[model samples]
Target: MRFADIVIPDTSATRGALEVATAYCSPALLNHSVRAYLWAAAYAGMNGIAFDAELLYVSSMLHDIGLVKEFDSHTVPFEEAGGHLAWVFAAGAGWPVERRVRASEVIVRHMWDKVDLAEDPEGHLLELSTALDISGRRPEDFPAGLRAEVLERYPRLGLGEEFIACFRDQAERKPDSLAATFVRGGVADRIRANALDG
Candidate 1:
């Protein structure tokens, strides 16, 4: 499935993942998820990184699910909670156990500072993509044309405010989680300063 110049994986698993994201995420978050996939896939294509499109799509779609009230965890960080949810979703999609575990790992690893592309291509792509989307880090790494097309297609839709609120709630509740660390580390300022928002 192609949206604009981006090639989305057209498969039952990918479709199912999109459906799950649409059902659970708010419009702003859902758009952010799709944009995350496009950014990652476009970067991979440009850089000659071999990746599993289906896995990346699925992981991207479900990566921030734990931020939604329906799936939020009290004790664990949102990324870990979302990773568990992705594991179950992959299993229901009839993925093999290894693939299911890989999906979970990819989602969880997106929150890390960096993921080694050689070890886990999907994880690395997702990490870079989400960082770019959320904080506007290294926007120049992607082509100017691709960035323009993606933002025009998906739009930010107040993601900066919505995401900051979600993180604030997470920080207040799970003061020890990574979300708290992000809050303490000035994630809101970073979000507001994102070049993409302009």
Candidate 2:
């Protein structure tokens, strides 16, 4: 069955951000990032939640950017680092401060165990989308064959293995960072229990 097609927002700024994010992030991270957007946007559509496609796209696309060594920090959490990096990228792309900050909130809070939906619904959708992509939470929610189509366009390419390693690296190097905290706080178990294996 053909699921509703997912539309990508492709303004000039969005295209530029994609290029920079692609240059910095690994293939798996990049694919996962884009898939996160697709999942979030699709979920929003299914749920009838109106959203800012541009902001969501940018935030989701750059969510894992802190993992890139060029922006890596020894002390700061990757989510926050990536948030700051995305903020800068957004600002450079001519986003107003308020909107850029909003986008950064989505990136910064994506790793949170639970995001406050009342405060930022976009971020909330993003958080849920990543959870769906990474761990397959509420598998019944997806439209039939939607996941297969997304994976075909942006294949996981062993993203699960790659991500777990990245999480381990964070746990080892920055024990106090969010990645480290989540990794130590049963993320591995979460991933294992929610394996994406078909």
TM-score on alpha carbons, each prediction: 0.96, 0.92
Model 2: per-residue lDDT, tens digit, 1-198? Answer: 233466689897779778987998899889889888888888878878788888888998888888888998777888888889888988899989998898789998898778876787789888998997776687677865887787788888777777888888988998877778778777776766654546
For residues 1-198, write the lDDT of model 1, one tens digit per residue. 124656788999999999999999999999999999999998887788899999999999999999999999887999999999999998899999999999999999998989999999999999999999999999998877778878898999999999999999999999998889889999999999999998
TM-score of 1: 0.96
Whole-model lDDT per candidate: 0.93, 0.82
Q: Model 1 residue 183 lDDT? A: 94
On lDDT, the candidate that comes out on top is 1
Task: Rate residue 1 of model 1 by lDDT.
Answer: 18
